[model samples]
Target: MSKLEDLKTAVINGKRKDVKTIVPELLESGADPVEMLEQALIPAMSVVGERFKKNEIFVPEMLVSARAMKEAMKIIEPILIEAGVKPEFKALIGTVEGDLHDIGKNLVATMWKGAGFDVVDLGVNVSPAAFVQAIEEHSPHLVGLSALLTTTMPAMRDTVEKIRGAGHDKVKVLIGGAPVTLEFAREIGADGYASDAASAVDAAREILAS
Candidate 1:
C-alpha cells in the first residue's frame, strides 16, 4: 500500500505512535492534507467503527484508534482549514445531564470530526436547557446525546423532549451509549441511533441529508 494507505490502516488498528509518525511523513512526501483526510483518516475510522459493531474490536481499541487519528488530525486540520475545506455539517454532542461519563461521547465526537462534520462538543453533564441553548446558538444539523448509565437514560429522553418543546424539531437528535438500545432511542423520539462510532457517522450523514 501507499504511504497514505499505510497511515490509514495504522490508524484503523489504533497505532497511536504510527499515526503520529506517519502523518508528518505523508506531508513531507507531498500528500495533500485534504486527500489524506478524505482518503485515509476518514475511511480508517469508518473501518474501526465497523469492527466495533461486529465485536471485532471494543471500546478500548476504538478509543486508542481515535486518539491516534486525532494525533494525525492535529497536523492536517490546519491545512484543511487553510484550503477552505470546511466541514459539511455541524453537530452538537454531549453526555446528558446526571451523566459524568465521557469516553463514549468523545469517541463519537472524534469520529464525527473525522467524517468532516464540525462538532460542537457540549462536554459532560449537559442539561436539557443547555441542549436548547446549543441548538439555538450553533444551529447544528444534528444533536447527539450519550448516556453510559441506565440511570441517565431518562435525561436523554428529557433533553429530546425539551428540544422539541423549544420548537427546534427540524434539528435531528441522535442517541447512543452502552445502555442505550435502538428501541430506547425510538422511544425517546430520537431521529437515529448508532451502537458504535462508525455507524454514528453514517447515521449523522443520513440525518443531515434528509
Candidate 2:
C-alpha cells in the first residue's frame, strides 16, 4: 500500500506511534494537509465507526483509533489553520450537571474532531446555565449533551430546555450516553440521538445537512 494508504491503515489499526511517524514523513514530502485529512485521517475514523456499529470492534478499539487520528490531527491542524483552512462546522460538547462520566463524551469529541468539526469540549458536570452561556459565546452549529446516569438524565433535559429557552433556534442539539435513548432525546426536544461516537458523527452531519 502507498504511504497515505499506510497512514489510513495505521489509524484503523490504532497504531499511534506509526501515525506519529508517518504524518511528519508525508508532510516533509510536501503532502497537502487538507489532502492528508480528507484522504487518510477522516476516512480511517469512518471505517472504525462502521466496524464499531457492526460489532466487529468495540469501545476500546474505537478509542485507540480515535486517539491515533488525534495524534495525526495534532500535526495537521496547525498547518491547516496557518493556511486558513477552517472546518465547516463547530460543535460544543459536555457532560450534564450531576453526572461525572466523561469517557463517552470525550470519545464523541475525538470522533467529531476526526470528522473535521471544530469541537469545543465543555467538560463534565456542566450546568444548563453553562450550556446556555456557551451557546451564546461559541454559537456552535451543534451541541452535544451527555448523561451517563438515569438519575442525571433530568439535567440533560434541563440543558436542552435552557438552550431553547435562550432563543437559540439555529443550533442543533444532539444527546447521547449509556442511559440516554432516542425516546428521551425526542421527549427532551433534542435534534438528534446517537448511541455512540460514530453514530454521533452521522447524526450531527444529518442534522446539519437538513
| Candidate achieving the largest lDDT | 2
- Candidate 1 residues 126-177, lDDT tens each? 9999999999999888999999999999999999999999999899998999
lDDT at 179 for candidate 1?
94
lDDT of 2: 0.92
lDDT of 2 at 188: 92
Q: Rate the local accuracy (lDDT) of all candidates.
A: 0.88, 0.92
CA error at residue 118 for candidate 1, angstroms: 3.0
lDDT per residue as tens, model 2, 1-210: 888999999999999999999999999999998999999988998888889878899889888998899899899989999999988899999999999999889988987987889999999999999999998999899999999999999998899999999899899999999988999999999999998876888999999997
lDDT accuracy of residue 110 in candidate 2: 81
Question: Estimated TM-score per prediction?
Answer: 0.82, 0.91
Off by over 4 Å in 1: 148-152, 178-184, 196-198
